[model samples]
Target: MCLIHFQYGEHPIFQLIVVANRDEIYDRPAEPAHFWEDEPEILAGRDLLEMGTWLGISKNGRFAALTNFRDPSLPKRPRSRGEIVRNFLKESVHPSEFIDELAKMKDCYGGFNVIVGDQNRLMHYNNIFDEKNEIFPGVHSVSNHTLNTPWPKVVKGKKRMVEYLKNNPGQVDIDELFEIVMDREIAPDEELPDTGVGLEMERNLSPAFIQLPHYGTRCSTVLLIDRVGNVTFVERTFNSGHFKFEKSFRFKIQK
Candidate 1:
């Protein structure tokens, strides 16, 4: 997913709330969110190349999101996309510690942006350019940039998300949050990073259409991690040809 809008410890009741969009090519192979029969602890879209995901949670209430870094300048590094998510689910490391370990590797494992957090803190790391930043306790949006610094889509999306959150500050469910991320109405004159998947044509064909059979936002996910170590996850997949939601899954995290 290219963008993640999250609120951690915002409400007195809920612990964590996140809305994300998984952007990728139209032809990549992937299955909707499902538990792997062999690896039951993991829950997300299976087998996506250039796919971003909200990885499985740990027993200790840790949450992580992995997205590709959009830097074409960096040399390719050796790292498996699935392995990154697997490691997050398998380990109990803090966000800072996890980022520290990622920074030591200079092998350029493709461009990646990882956000990991819990009830108390949030950390974001960009491996493409070797940059890292932390978000204080507040409503924030992370795109392909480092925080909010006027990167066209990032700036415009952040403003739109904040405005939505301000107006609808009530306890939001997963679907409501997904609507905010799937919003593609605001078109800026600035250029966007080319995904080589022909998003322009897709957008032109269907502005509100999510082309599932070929390309577009393949998945919309919302993850809620409560204070008591309970994690709730929901994912929806769009139809490839019709751009309508085809399937969905809702489940909780168990050891």
Candidate 2:
């Protein structure tokens, strides 16, 4: 499970604020945000050859995320979760329209919760076994459920996010937001959402060192989009594997 906290058009000079966590199995190889020779303009990760990223943003003001819908009973399908992120970054479609397109392809894949947004709009999509839904704008949280499933983690994460937003308001920059999104230390007794892997193995195989690897916050990122169409992006990762995020960069979209 992953969390994203963002505010659009809330700051004086900043037009957008984003903070997110990239959650995945500890063993999955991944690179930090970087531009690949194959995909030059893409800056989040060269070729994230692991699970889909929880969130990403493009210089064109497009942003997206993919979350697995908890379903231990459903049979797994033959699809690449990474493709979801690739498709979103490679395309320039609007969030709502992109979600509509995703719904049509739902049958081709397994259960998932997806969010795509920009400075002007945001949308969510859910495809469980028998139920499906689209989330509307306003403060909302998407975890293993469709959206706001009342799961303890979902509820607590949303509440914490709201409290942070309320207290920080316009002053909530990327760094502060990161602390909130990566706040796994809070409420230690709160049961964490199981990642399908056993707790024992999770502890052993998970990334341990926050700076090197084997277990820790895998990646932290922030994407800002100003009203004038300028974008600022930053990403950091722990460990050395298939992923490595380059230094932060700021750029503008061609009008």
Candidate 3:
């Protein structure tokens, strides 16, 4: 996932709301979000090459998402960062415990930011910076760096999310959340972050929805969990900068 905006425990009716986009090369084979056949409790998009997931939720209210840090100077780790989400979903450990354990062996994976939680609470952990935060829930965004790092797209998306929820009090227009993730407007050069990637690459990645010659956003995922333990997950897939199809799932949080 490249850009993610989520609010937990901030609204009257909703417990958790998330809007995220997964950006990758056009040809990376991936399975759209679904209940994994082998692990029926998990619902998420599959990274076929790595046999892992970028984001997902379990039938019992467990949720997790992963994003890679934007530093090429870092060495490649033996493990795929995507496994962080997959392992969190597959395990029954408390969110904080899971993150604490990972922190002890953080160097096994490349720089990454991951969020894991249930309806009870949310936690943010990054191996690159050796940081773990208990998210308190107004509105938060994370990208290819730390959580709420003030990157152009992260700032813009979080602001839009706060406004969207405020404007549409008591109800969430799922499609509107999709609109936020679909934004392709590149940020003004002055607002772009210099992450060591040259100016051209930075500009290319400045937009919430990235579109490049051979690589771009593959899917946008919107997940809403209500206070009553109901979940609505929607994923829209794209190809060559065009909308392809959408897959949605609605289930009650078992826990």
Candidate 4:
């Protein structure tokens, strides 16, 4: 997932709500979100090339999402960062322990930021940074940099999220949540962040929803976890900004 905008512990109905977009080359082979045949308890889209996932949730109320830390200086590592989310959901481990172990092997992976843990606690980790942070209550976002870094899209998404939640209280509107992440408005060049990517490329990637010709946002996913341990996960896959398919799943947490 390249962009993740979410609310934690602030909403009355759902304790955790996640809206994220996955950006990749259009030709990269990937499947829509589904329960894995091998890891039956895991539900997430699979990266066909690496056999890993960018975001996922498990049967036991555990959920995790990831974003790459954009840095042109660092060379690609031996591992796919997607494996971090995949492995977290596949194993039965505490969040703290998982984060500690990730720190030990941080060098093995490329620059990336991960928001992981179960419903009760979520932690953020970036290999370039030295610490793992406990995601506090309220709206938070993460993209190609650190979490809540306030890039144009992150700020726009978070503002829209807060307003939507504030105005439409009591019940969750799934469509509206999806629409927030579906925004395709490109940020003005003056506001674009200099991530070492050239001005033109940065402008293309500035929007909450990117629609480039060969590379862009491939999918958008919204995950809702209610106080009663009920989960509603919806994912929409696309190709070059054109909608292809959508998958929705709901289940009560095992624990």
Q: Which candidate is the best by lDDT?
A: 3
Against the true structure, candidate 3 has what lDDT? 0.92
lDDT (tens digit, per residue) of candidate 2 on 81-140: 556766787788766677677777776667787777667766667766434444443346
TM-score per prediction, in order, is 0.77, 0.75, 0.98, 0.98
lDDT of 2 at 207: 22
- lDDT of every model, 2 decimals: 0.62, 0.60, 0.92, 0.92
> How many clashes would you count in candidate 1?
9
Per-residue lDDT over 63-137 for candidate 3, one digit per residue giving the tens place of the 0 to 100 score: 999898998788888988888999999999999999999999899999989999998899999988899999997
Q: What is the per-residue lDDT of model 1 for residues 1-255, given as tens digits with 9 covering 90 to 100?
A: 666777766655556777777766757677777666655665666665644344555545556777665544656666665566666655778778888887887254667777776667888877756778887765666665555434445555556656765666665555666666666553442444453436564233222223444556767777776656566777766545234553444434444
> Ten-residue segment with the worst summed lDDT in candidate 2?
203-212
Off by over 4 Å in 1: 48-54, 190-214, 241-255
User: Could you give candidate 4's per-residue lDDT for residues 51-148 as a string of tens digits?
Assistant: 99999999998899999888788887998989999999988889889999999999999999998887799999988885699989999999998988
> Could you list the CA RMSD of all candidates, in the order they appear?
4.1, 4.6, 0.8, 0.8
Candidate 4 lDDT at 191 equals 88
lDDT of 1: 0.62
Order the candidates by lDDT, highest first — what do you get? 3, 4, 1, 2
- Backbone clash pairs for candidate 1 read 1-52, 26-214, 26-215, 69-111, 69-112, 77-108, 77-109, 212-240, 213-240
Candidate 3's C-alpha runs over 4 A off are none
